[model samples]
Target chain A: MKEFSLIDTYFRDVSFQRKDVLLGIGDDCAITQIPAGQALATTTDTLVSGVHFLPDADPKAIAQKAIAVNLSDLAAMGAEPAWLSLSLSLPNVDENWLKAFSEGFKELTEYYSIQLIGGDTVQGPLAITITAQGFVAADQALKRSGAKPGDFVYVTGTLGDAGLGLDILQDHTDVDNAEHKAYLLNRLHYPSPRVFAGTSLRRVANACIDISDGLLADIKHILKASQCGACLQLDKLPLSSAMVDSVDQDSAFHYALSSGDDYELLFTVSEEQKSSVDRVLACSNVPATCIGQINGAVGKVDLKFNDESYAYSQTGFEHFNSGESSNKHRNNAKRA
Target chain B: MKEFSLIDTYFRDVSFQRKDVLLGIGDDCAITQIPAGQALATTTDTLVSGVHFLPDADPKAIAQKAIAVNLSDLAAMGAEPAWLSLSLSLPNVDENWLKAFSEGFKELTEYYSIQLIGGDTVQGPLAITITAQGFVAADQALKRSGAKPGDFVYVTGTLGDAGLGLDILQDHTDVDNAEHKAYLLNRLHYPSPRVFAGTSLRRVANACIDISDGLLADIKHILKASQCGACLQLDKLPLSSAMVDSVDQDSAFHYALSSGDDYELLFTVSEEQKSSVDRVLACSNVPATCIGQINGAVGKVDLKFNDESYAYSQTGFEHFNSGESSNKHRNNAKRA
Candidate 1:
């Protein structure tokens, strides 16, 4: 069928356009009015099938992840989630699949008090895209470009749990311990977004970023944007007992330092405000660990382990690398 | 690689959680403060490879169309385009592909003067999602429900050209003539957005929609929302000379009424305001034709053809139906 015809059959519902919607689906554009005093924060993301998720992965997980990841972006910016639009590409329209997907999407949306403002759904291989919008007061935002030399670097919660979870899922890691297995699985299946902590950190964080990339790599982003470097104390890396118990101390350290997907916040604060930072994090009821200190050195990140410094070869995850598919890495090593 | 690693490599760089960005990627949410007296009109669309376009379709066109379609949504709302976020899913991190896509994206962004703010990128089937933001004056935006009985139904530009172009691309019909074929192809390749017309209509037209779906189906949305019906004068339907020369009158009528993807503005204005509309259309330099009138009848659309009134079959394009593939329709019949 023609593109327009396809849109009409599957998408053109009057319900898609609401009373609050100044314009909707059929137009060259849709218009909206934001209430005064709200600054608009916009974001977009594309999730490819097979690349972003398993082809047969649960639709609910997929939907939840889509929003969660986007919401994480808003959190980093200290913005409040307001509305979102979704675009889906499917091989075909499976009613059961759509119902499940929408249910999962609505669940997270309602929980967060976000509205499904507008989006387009179409046919193709399974790909989902979402554009999310949030509101925040003007000037109250966290950015990667504001870190200065001598700032104290901090991270919320533990790092590398998601990465460890991924390692566990890639192979049959014989974790006879059920609790440990469940913990790892939970990390993989559901990630807690540090929204509250993020909101609270707006005033204190000189620079902030979420650790979707490994902490080292993500810190590089802040350093590059802020034009500084950092020296992380290896012993200070925050890791869970479960993660440490699953592997050797060295491997656990490696994971905590380099494995990605903790979804925790890595931020820098001025040295004079270190106590205030600690107090704010405590008041907000989230773990905040000081891992390092920013320095004036350019393009260098030092890891001080024991009395000597260790040089790392790999720079965290690179999208098309062939050296170690997590699955393959699991088969070669028995660390977990 | 795990999903988190994929996101970091490809998507993290997209966010700039700066002051204007109140919230940005990596948080549980992002928020924005809307400027005073501006209402936020938002819309989203998803495009999947092989479903929305041929797998080999130009990346530039795909990128351009992705943003253009969302902009079309903003236009439908009679809102001015502002910011856009993109979610992309790709199979591989092919630098060449990304470079081309970004180039295309940047081109249209410059043309439309919209900013690429933030979003996530992940692995999956080639899927693209974009959420676009636009602004309209508070309390003065147009809506579909505003159409009233006795309002003159109007459509800007010609219709059905996109459908015919699709037919040619699918090789469903032999394009014995070149000029007519070029016109059709151009319509499909570069569908112009009627932003000026739509925004202008906000001041005068009772309601409006963009023709992404066929005329009959789209009009149904207005009718259902307005609790009214319409009687379209088939002969008054706008058709290009090329379309008329290529197809018979009846078939041409079918294309004009049911063929979608025109991306032109279909709107309504009060009969008492006809002269004013004419003057406005002339001043705005957009060609428009009055094709019908809204009636008190609830949820019905009738067509006047050859002095005989009949109900439109209400069939054109749909995503789920199997009988009318663009290729099949074009190959099976020389309808246009």
Candidate 2:
């Protein structure tokens, strides 16, 4: 079948039964109903072959990661996922690849109750762009600008596993532990969007952001937006047992701080809200730890271990920072 | 500058003063307020280097066409354009290119009262995926399924100019009339989205579609969805004087029926509603001509040229039809 036919056959019927979706596929435009007094939230992410993922990566993994990363944006805003539009650029028609990709895309979207509303298929280098839309009540939506000077910083889930996973995939690092390799690889390929934790933090998190460009880089966005600084305790950084087993402590710390693609929530909460934030995270059954505090020195971020400041090898991932060799060093391992 | 910094420098301050957009750029997700009792209309389109346009094509024209095609979809649905998100993948960073592209993007969006709410830019091959959102009343959106057996079919503006433009670009056709070449090239690169005509025809048009994939192929979509057929009068198809002067009558008809990217609205109205439709079109100051009628015979489409039948050499553009040599033939003059 042709590209259009392949979409009709595999993707046209994968609607997730969203009540808010008035129209799905097969139209010039998809129709959606946003509830009154609510604001619709939207985000888009494009995953390109060789840049965002391996050109020979599994189709299922590619589709899942694409959807998950976009969903993570909605999660950072404390919004409820409702619908998505996909634009797929392909080098050629491959039915089996498309089937696996759609299945993986459907799997996460179904779990989030997001209907696949519309899509455009074209011939080109392989790239998948997904626009995910959700709803958040007015200013009740979380923003990076909401962080306060006295707020405590927190992150959901363990970090560095996905970064280590990329290292493993690129054959840059070797590990003898089979279980560690498997878990790290899963973290790299199928990092879960922290939706439950993000939504719950709407009442607690003063500001929120999803860690796609590493903790050091993403946290700086919150600081810049809120016009504040942060003091982080490096020893408090959370690392999965699998990541700890795969790499040394220093290597693990570097990955946790500078690696991208973790898809975890990094947020700040007021001193008064910290207890409630902890309570909510516990209730959501997501592991979270306080690792820093927002400070008065605007736009400054300091990382230390027990009051001893340590020089870092790199800051974080930035797509346009190719001039600085350190950024290349960061991308090499994180994007392996 | 970093990727996020580049976005902040180039894209953040373009709020467009949209009152409904409570939040735009800088956040994880943009926030929009949809009025009560209204449905949000969304469509996505992806344009790739080499496939959609030459890699060396003007960035301004590329940006304009990208937004225009998506707006054309909204126009087909009779929705009022509102918000849009852009996902841009670039092979490398070039400031002059980005500046020209943004200027072109801002030009059309400013006139249409649409807001650029959010975007994601990454390093990769050149491809742009834009998702446009609009608003329509509940159950009032125009659909291909609404056509009836007795509906009179009409098309807005001229057909086949863009196809001729592509022919001119590829050096496939040579004409002495420089004026005609200029006209055709403009039509190809900047075909106006029929926002005024489409919205006005909401009450009169039983069904509506934008001509992206030629009259014959696009009209078939209407027929397929409405479970009907159509009989088109080949002689009545609206063609510019330049088009008629540049090509023979048969060639003009072939491009009108088989080429793509006209971006005109092809709609059907009941016979009784034809006068009203005409009146609406007149008030909107857009030229439209009746050329056919819907029929009761399901899926049967017949074209007649002054009482004689004609066979088409091509259908429409399908991305992955290249395995068949005929697909390359279709792409030749249309995509050149």
Candidate 2 lDDT by residue in tens digits, B1-336: 668877877766553669999889889999999988889999999999987888988888999899999999999999989998999898888989988888888888888989999989998888889999999996779998999988899999999888878877877776568787789899988889998888898888989999998888899889999999999999999998778887777778877887788999999998788889778888768899999889858887788888677666578766677555222442322111
Clashing pairs in 2: none
| Alpha-carbon DockQ of candidate 2 | 0.83
- Given candidate 2, what's the lDDT at residue B44? 98
CA displacement after TM-score superposition, residue B114 of candidate 1 (Å): 2.4
Q: lDDT: which candidate is best?
A: 2
Error of 2 at B306 (Å): 2.4
Whole-model lDDT per candidate: 0.71, 0.86
Show the lowest summed lDDT stretch of 10 residues, model 2 chain B: B327-336
DockQ of 1: 0.47
Report the C-alpha lDDT of model 2 over A1-336, residue by residue, as the tens digit.
Answer: 666577789898765787878778988999889888789999999999988899999999999899999989999999988898999988888888988999998888888878999989998899999999998897789998999988899999998788878877887775668888899899989989998887888888889999998999999899999999999999999988787666666777888998899999999988888888768877768988999899958988888887899677577778877655332342332211
Off by over 4 Å in 1: A1-35, A322-336, B1-34, B92-103, B310-314, B323-336
Please state the interface RMSD for every predicted structure, separated by commas: 4.3, 0.9
